[model samples]
Structure formats: C-alpha cells, structure tokens
Target: MINLINISKSYGENHAVRSFDLTIETAETTVLIGPSGCGKSTILRTIIGLISPDTGKVNIEGEALSTANLVSLRQKMGYVIQEGGLFPNLSAEGNVFLMARYLGWDKDRIEERIDELCELTKFPKDALNRYPIQISGGQRQRLSLMRALMLDPNILLLDEPLGALDPLIRSELQQDLKEIFSTLGKTVVMVTHDMGEAAFFGDKIVLIKDGQIIQEGNISDLIKTPSNPFVTTFINAQRNHLEIIGDI
Candidate 1:
C-alpha cells in the first residue's frame, strides 16, 4: 500500500499540488486524470521522489519516504515517463541495464534480468541492440517498461506513458498494458489527459482540478452520479472518446 498524505508542492509562486491525499492499494491501478497543467504529473514526480513536496510526506508499505529510506524505498518502485525517456546514446539493452550496472550487478545477472524483462514486455531480443531512434514509438515504450520492471518493483508510476503514439499504436499499447498490469498485479499510478485511456487503464480514477481531487471512483460511479458540475462537464467533454472506446 502507498499513502500520499496531505501532500503539497509549489513552483516559485505557483502551487502545483495542494493538500493532496491519496491511498494506492496493492495490485490496484489508480489513475490521476485531469486537464493539462492540473498537477497530475507533479503528484507522480513527488511520489517517485523526483522532487520533494513543500509540505507533507509519502509512505510506502507503512514505511515513511524520508531521506534515510528514500533510496531503499525507491528500489521497490519503478517509474516510466513520457515517450520512454530513453537516452539517445544507449541501446535498448543498455538503457534497461543502466541502473542494474550502477548497482554493481554482475554481467551475467544483468543479462539474465534483461532477457526476462524483454520477454515480459514482449520485446524482440534481436532488437535489444537498437537505439531509441531505431525503434518505433510503441517499441520504445516496451523498452521503457522492460527497464522499469527489470528490478521487479512492487509499485509502478507512469506519467503519460502512451501520450505520444498515434491512435492505432496507442490503442494497441493500451490493451497490451492492461494485460500486463493484470498479469503483474503491481500497484500502479498513472497520469493522463485522455479520459478514454483513464477509463480503460484505471481500476480506480482520481480526477483533479486546481491541484485538488475533484472525485475518486470507478468510471460508472463518476458518470452516473457525479459529485459536482465539473465531474459532469469533464466527462461530457470527452463523451465521444468514451463512447468510441466503448467505455460509456
């Protein structure tokens, strides 16, 4: 279980997140969905320790996320950013093994883990030598997943993981990712602007506005009995998408 208790963050004078609170249970896929700049990514970053919140703290599996435990705590979590975030200079295998190598994993051990992750992400072993530029957008995402899962973390944090792909590729990845999540049973928190994606990927949806949670529930609960006008408005804005994706 993960607890984001009373979390808040700011950028100079702008508040990115405000008094936010959320609990991510083990094996559940929780999605942070909202409009652009609504602080969805900020929450993910804060949870992953990419940046500290101005106030409050995070807890993973009953352990507090502090300086003393951050490193060790992070070892139990995997993070993926938009478009794979792969380094240009490294090959797919290199990118996947970078962290393991830094942790002093032996060559054979690293290779074994890489092979396992490749199969898990459904990536071709022969293409491991290819750089980020040499692969398709979808493939880069698979590589990114492989890297994130190489350590076999219990929690997965993703920020717009499929935001860059074309509709066809994006649709394919969405299904694949759903299956992957179901198979892994890892706690997941993902940020996305697409309601369709949220409806499809998330077991529970958390909608935010002005850095605060507007509503948190499953798709049917939000659509059938909205807490406020914004909930209705937000869903109406993406009605076509929700219907097209057969989510409605």
Candidate 2:
C-alpha cells in the first residue's frame, strides 16, 4: 500500500499540491483525475520520489519514504510517464534491461527477463533492437511498460500512460493494460484527465480540483451523488467525451 498523508508542494507562490491525502491499497488500481493544472501528476511524482512534498509523509508498504531510504524505495517501484519517456537513442531491449544491468544481473538472466517482459507486454521480439523514434506510438508505449515491469516492482505508477496515442491505439492499450494489471496484481496509481478511463481502470477514483481531492469513489457514486457543483461539471465533461469515444 502507498499512503500520502497531508502532502503539499509549492512552486514560488503557486501551490501545486495542497494538503493532499490519499491511500492506494495493495493489488488495487487507484486513479487520480482532474483538470490540467489540478495537481494529479504532482501527487504521482511525489509518490514516485521524483518530487518531494514540502510537507507530509509518504509511506510505502511498511516503510516510510525518507532521504536515506529513497533510493531503495524507488527501486521497489516502477514508473511510466507521458510519451513513453523512452530513450530515443537506445534500443527497446537496451531500455528494458537498463536497470537490471545496473543492478549487476548476469547477461543470461537479463535476456531471460527481457524475453518474459516482451511477451507479457505483447511487444514483438523482432522490434527489441529498434530505437524509440523508430517505433509507432503504441509500440513505444509497450516498450515503456516492458521497461517499467522489467524490475518486477511491487507497485506501478503511471502518468497519462495512453494520452499520446491515437484513439484506436489508446483503446486497445487500455484493455491490454487492465488485463496485465489484473494478471500481475501489483498496486497501481495512475493519473489521467479522462473520466471514462478512470472508470475503466480505477478500483477507486479520486477526483481532485486545485490540488485537493474533492471526492473519492467509483463512477456510480460520482454520477449519483456528486460532492459539489465542480464534481458534477467534471463528470459531465467526461460523460461528453465518452459520448464521442463510446463507453470504454
């Protein structure tokens, strides 16, 4: 489980994340959703140790995230960000095996694991030698997933993982990702602005506005009993999107 207790982050005069609190249970997928500047990604970064909150505690499983434990803590988590975040110069296999090599895993073991991840993410082994720029958006994203899962971390964090793909590709990857998540059963926390995606992926949807979570529940709760007018508006916006995309 991951816990963010009273977390807050500030940039100059702007408060990016304000006194936010969220708990992500083990083996469950939790999604953070809100508008563009609403701080969903900020919260995710904090969890991944990419950004340290000015205030509050981050506890992962039984260990609290601190300066001394940050490195090891991060090693136990996998993170995937927007645009695949792959190295444009490196081959897909190189990117996936990067961490394992750094950790001193033998060549044969690395090859074995890379093979497993390629199959798991449905990435073609033939394309493993291709650079990020050489692959399609969907394939690049698949490589990113393979890289993240390469370490076999206990938790996974994603920030708008499918936001860059075409509609058809996005829809296909979303279904595949959910199946992978279920098969692995690792705790996951993802950020996205799409409500339909949230409903499809999240066991619990945490709706945020201006850095604070305004409501947390499933789709039924949000549609039936919104906590405020803002929540209603947000849901309506996504419902409109769903009308365009058809339900996920």
Candidate 3:
C-alpha cells in the first residue's frame, strides 16, 4: 500500500500541489482526473520521488521515502510517461529488458520476461528488433508500458499513457490496458483528462481542480450524484448528450 500525507510541491512562487493526501491500496486502480495545469502530473512526480515535496511525507508499505529508501522504493514501482520516454537508439526488446538487466537478471530470465511482457501487451514479435522511431506512436506507447512492467513492479504509475495516440488507437489501447491490469492485479494510479477513460478503468476516481481534490468516489456514484456544479459539468462534458438527463 502507498500512503501520501499532506504532499505538496511548489515551483518558485507558484504552488503546483498543496496539502494533497491520498492512499492507494494494492491491486486496485485509482484514476486522477483534472483539467490542464491542475497539478495532476505533479502528484505523480512527487509519488515517484522525481520531484521533492516542499512539505509532506510519502510512505510505501510503511517505509518512508527518504534518501536511504528512495532507490529501493522506486525499483518496486513502474512508471509510464506520455512520450513513452524510450531511448531512440535502443530496440524494443532492449528497452523492455533494461531495468531487469540493471538488476543483474540472468540472460535467460531476462529473455523470458521480455517475451512475456510483449505477449501481455500484444506487441508484435518482430517489433522487438525495431527502434522507437521505427514503430508507430501506439506501438511506442505499448512498448513503454512493457518496459515499465518488465520488472514486475507491485505498483504502476501511468501519466496520460495514451495521450499521443489517435482516437481509435487510444480506445483500443485503453481496453487492452484495462484487461492487462485485471490479469496482473498490480496496484495502478493513472492520470487522465478523459472522464470516460477514467470511468472505464478506475475502481475509484479522484477529481481535482486548482491543485485540490474536489471530490472522490466510484465513477457511477459521481455521475449519479455530483457534489456540486463543477462536478456535474465535468461529468456531463465527457458523457454523450444522449446519456445525460435533467439539469446537469
């Protein structure tokens, strides 16, 4: 389990996140949704120790994320970014096995894990030899996911993982991701702007605005009973007009 207590971060005088608190249990998916610049990405960065919180504590399974434990904690978490963040020079197989290799995994074990991840993500076998630039955007994103899962981390953090794909590809990948998560039973935290995507994949949804959580609940509950006008408007904007009824 991951526990975040009063996590906050600032960039110069502007505060990106303030007094944020959240708990992510094992084997569940938590989706964070908000408009642009709402500090959604900041929260992910803080959790991963990529950005230091001005004042707060982050604990993973009761272990504090201090300098001594940060490295170990990071190793136990998988992080996927929007751009895929793949090395241009490396092949898909190379990228997927990078972390395992760093951890001194044997050649046979690394090969087996790479093959398993590619199959899980439905990546083509031939794509393993290709570099990131040679693959399509969707394929790159899938490869990025495969890399993150290579180590079989207990926790997965995805930041707009499907944002770069076209609409059709985006929807397809989203379904694939949902199924993968279900089968793997890994704890997941995803940040997305699309409410429908959040609703479909998240066991719990957290809505944020101006670096603060406005509301949090199951997607069905939020849609049925919005706490305020903003929550109603946000949900309506994502829903088809045919699905929305009454004053929203």
Which prediction has the highest lDDT against the true structure?
A: 2
Better of 1 and 3 by lDDT: 1
Consecutive 10-residue window with the lowest summed lDDT within model 3: 239-248
- The model with the greater TM-score, 1 or 3, is 3
Give per-residue lDDT, candidate 3, residue 28: 94
TM-score of model 2 (CA atoms) = 0.96
Question: Model 2, stretches more than 4 Å misplaced?
Answer: 241-248
The lDDT of each candidate is 0.91, 0.92, 0.90
Give residue 134's lDDT in candidate 2 (0 to 100). Answer: 88
What would the per-residue lDDT of candidate 1 be over residues 1-248, giving only the tens digit for each residue?
Answer: 99999999989889889999999889999999998889999999888788899999999999888888889888889998887889999998999998899899999999888877777788999999999999999999999998889888999999999999999988888888998999999999999988889999888999999899999999999999899899989988987855658963
Give the Cα error of residue 71 in candidate 3, in Å: 1.7
lDDT of 1 at 201: 85
- Number of clashes recorded per candidate: 0, 0, 0
Q: Which order, best to worst by TM-score?
A: 2, 3, 1
Model 3 Cα lDDT, one tens digit per residue, 106-206: 99999888889888999998989998999999999999999989889999999999988899999899899999999999999999999988999999999
**lDDT at 210, model 2:** 91
lDDT per residue (tens digit) for residues 1-248 in model 2: 89899999999999999988888899999999999999999999999788989999899997889889999999899999889899877788989998899999999999999888887889999999988888999999899999999889999999999999999999999999999999999999999999989999999999999999999998898889999999889888767654767855
